[model samples]
Target: MNLLFSNDKRGDYPQSWYAASADLLAPFAPLGGVQRADVCVVGGGYTGLSAALHLAEAGLDVVLLEAHRVGFGASGRNGGQLGSGQRLDQLKLEKMLGAEDARRMWEFGEEAKALVRGLVERHGIDCHLRDGVGWAGSSAGSVAELHDYAAHMDARYGYGLEVLDREAFAALCRSPDFQGGVLDMGAAHLHPLRLALGLAEACVRAGVRIYERSHVHHIQHGSKVVVQTDAGRVEADHLILGCNGYLGGLDRKVAARVMPINNFIVATEPLGDRAAEVLTRDVALCDDRFVVNYWKLSDDKRLLFGGGESYGYRFPSDIRAVVRKPLAQIYPHLADVKLEYAWGGTLAITMKRLPHLARVAPNVLSASGYSGHGVGNAVQAGKLMAEAVRGQASGFDAFAALPTPAFPGGAGLRTPLLALAMSWFALRDKLGL
Candidate 1:
């Protein structure tokens, strides 16, 4: 399958509600000729921009190249849930990599949230940041599990969480589908595209050079790395690859470590009084299932519903049709609501459901495979990459040390195998497994 990035230009912005709502305020020229910098970062999304900001602040001459406009990929199209921690549960992480490492990982997630908050305030980014996120249970069994999970977090990690009964949760969400859930104050939701744009602006203000529409086609690595774009080239002491699922053949090793999965979302027409009756609070709500339904009310009172995943490279012909069922399953009243816009974005996934961070070569680093949890982890990965390049490799090494196995059957057969495996999980979700 041709990579998503290899396809023809899909236009600057998708018809998602976020793009329609948020104000994009920055514009940068594309790379025109050969340039030299202390660090050359590829992909102008959150990861690349964050790395550029940190490196430039450290006095490194940083140059960032994006294939399209900044935040044109998943960074602009995500559900905007600033979720806490890695994709795996804390206990699961502890079991996988000892308690000491798990605690440090948890701390890193905390720092990620704090970093986002600090950048928003320090850079004066108007991304509509808010607190509190609810994890709605899809079934009674999941409700019990959430309650247990909440209790464990409070007991072991001392993380404050409110466990809501079915009645309380239904009152909060105004949905009968969920039995109960947990409300975590630490997690949050925000305007993702705005945040991405803000980071790009911040990078520029920090004296980092940004080149838009400069797709990196090749790289020559040695003591110093040289990145070649379609129209220009960049020579730098270090190179950072931040393109997630849209990453093409720029680096085959990092590309093979992740499987690109396409996900879609839909935004409903403004509900006015009807929206108020649907959600008691403005907090984002995500269900507990393999293929979870995550929704939140936009500041404009539109319902931004996100769900549905595809292992194939091509997006579904009718994205709304593929997402409507899941949206209705959560909010049956919304079955009649008019969907204003629908769009899809691709994300990278790993077999162990963990992010893949590693060094492809000396002075060359790459991080992807955030799965469905890129909002926070991606930013953290960029910060860690900066630290590694600055010679403080302890934290970065911890994550880079995590084992990332290659996809089975190589790239040729990986997508089909992933589709087959994901189908079993989707079936389990339907059976309430």
Candidate 2:
């Protein structure tokens, strides 16, 4: 089954808290006839929208096609935490790509956050952007390691982080599972769907032709790339694949390197004053679990908790139940609380847990496999692709130079293989290994 059509209704967003609470824009019409543009961007998440917006601003005729609505994918349904750095820590990156490249990567990651903030401010996208992300250690050893990493980032890059001891962390998080934690003041959180819809509005204002519900089924690669949807087509000078997890057989090379996975989240009933009893602060929180659990209080004081993953095509029938177990693990008092909303989203990951940016063809660029750091990475990837299309490719080349290995069984068998590997890691996490 195609991930684009799996688990969710065609041409509809999931019944997510983000969707319910967002000021969603009126749906853009699907593409219905042949069109020509300077660039055709497939997939209407952050990457496509941002790229289209930037390109249009640069006086390029841009067409962005989305299977359903803009931001209807992981961009609208994620944890909404825009944390510091890439999916892999910078220290690990130093060893993998050497200090120079790693340092450049870190700088790019930092600039990604700045880009998001600048976009929001300049375009007036009111997505409740807030700073401070908490990194709680799952174990004492994990806690110590987090502390050391905090120091490392602060010393190396002058990144600001407040390391909290056990008592202070407990006062802020009120979680027995979370002892001491580090608060990255530079990181941020926001209403993801609002940000996406806001960007779509900005794109339209910037002259981007956005076609919603226009699913791309085939692509003809050449000097003039042709993108085919059921009732419409786009011929453009450049093509960008921002499909991420929803990409299905669009490009074989990208498919081999990027694997899609499902994640679930739930929002609890408004906690009122009890919100302070649970989390004394407004910081977004995440732990060091192999399958990480992240949570924060919504503007209305509801607890928005994201956890659980499945190595399958379908989301669990009862997403609420699937997430409740982990919610109990972190906050027992909220275990039986009323679930206001529960939803699942698909996101892609690379073998090394870093984003994969590649020039799949001379004029066709693809960016995906952001792991859990898409909020910042996706937007930056979009801007870099926009730059590359204008013949300024140094930034894009830097990202493309990072190695992205194909999965052992490629895309077809990766599901089963990933299932086995994730099960092993989950078991190790249970055993605290």
Candidate 3:
């Protein structure tokens, strides 16, 4: 089944809290007849919008196509946590890619966060950008590991983090379940949908043509690539696949490495007088679990809690119930609060939890599989892809050199196999392993 159309209505945004509050732009008409550009970007989320904006600013004729509205996918529906490092931890990356490359990767990750901040400031995009992200630990061992990692980051990378004991953590989070935590001042959170829509507005201002509700049917590869849509086609000197989890059968090589998965989130009704009881500060919190529970207070004093995962193609029917279990586990006092919104979105995951950036052809590039850390990395990937199209490919090449193995059993059986594996992991998480 096509992920883009399977779980959501065509050309319509999901009934998410993000959508409810966003200042959405007028819809861009679908592509018609024929079109040509110096670069054709498929997907209108962070990656594609950023790429199109940068490419157009460089004086390249750019066109970006989205099957739905901008930010209608995971970009708008995610937990909105802009994490500090790559998906994998530094020590693990050092072991996998060695010290020198790992150091470079760390710099890239820092640059990713800086890029997001700079873009927001330069473009005047007001998305309630706020600093501080706390990592809450589940067990004593996990707490100790997080404390050590915070020290490692400080000593090795000069990144400061405030380590919190159980008492201090509870004071801030008001959750007795957390053993300890660490707060990273460098990381931040924002209104994800507003950030995306702002970027789309900036892209349009920079002369990038955006087409919504234009689904790509196929791509004919050649020196000048031809991207086919239902009502029209785009012939371009360069093609970029930023479709992420919504990318169907556009490119077989990319499909093999980037697997789509569903994740859900729910928002509580506005808790005016009791907002401080849930979160003392307006910072985001994420726990150490295989299936993590992340939450933060919205600007309107509502708790935006994101949790639960479904291995299948579709989301659970009762998304609120799926998320409420974890929400209550952390904040039992707010267990019976009214849920105003519950929604799900698709995201791409890889075996190694690292992003996959590849040059499918000399003129065709693809980047996805950011795991859960796409807020920063995805935007950086877009800029790097734009650089590659502009004849400076060192950055893109560095990311492309990373390993991205295909899932076993190919396309048909990989989902079921992953489901079985995830069930075991979920059990381990439940058992406190």
Give the runs in model 1 whose Cα sits over 4 Å from its true position: 1-11
lDDT of 2: 0.92
Stretch of 10 with least lDDT, candidate 1: 2-11
Model 1 residue 4 CA deviation (Å) reads 4.2
Q: Compute each candidate's TM-score over C-alphas.
A: 0.97, 0.99, 0.99
Locate the minimum summed-lDDT window of 10 residues in model 2. Answer: 328-337
lDDT (Cα, tens digit) per residue for candidate 3, span 66-95: 999999899999999888879898989999
For model 2, residues 293-398, the per-residue Cα lDDT tens digits are 8999999999999998997689999999999988998898776689989999999999999899999999999999999999999999999999999999999999
lDDT of 1 by residue, 91-133 (tens): 8899998988888888888888988888889999999899988
* C-alpha local distance difference test of each model: 0.86, 0.92, 0.92
lDDT of 3: 0.92
Measure candidate 3: CA RMSD: 0.8
Candidate order (lDDT)? 3, 2, 1
**How many clashes in each candidate?**
0, 0, 0
The alpha-carbon lDDT assigned to residue 285 of candidate 3 equals: 93
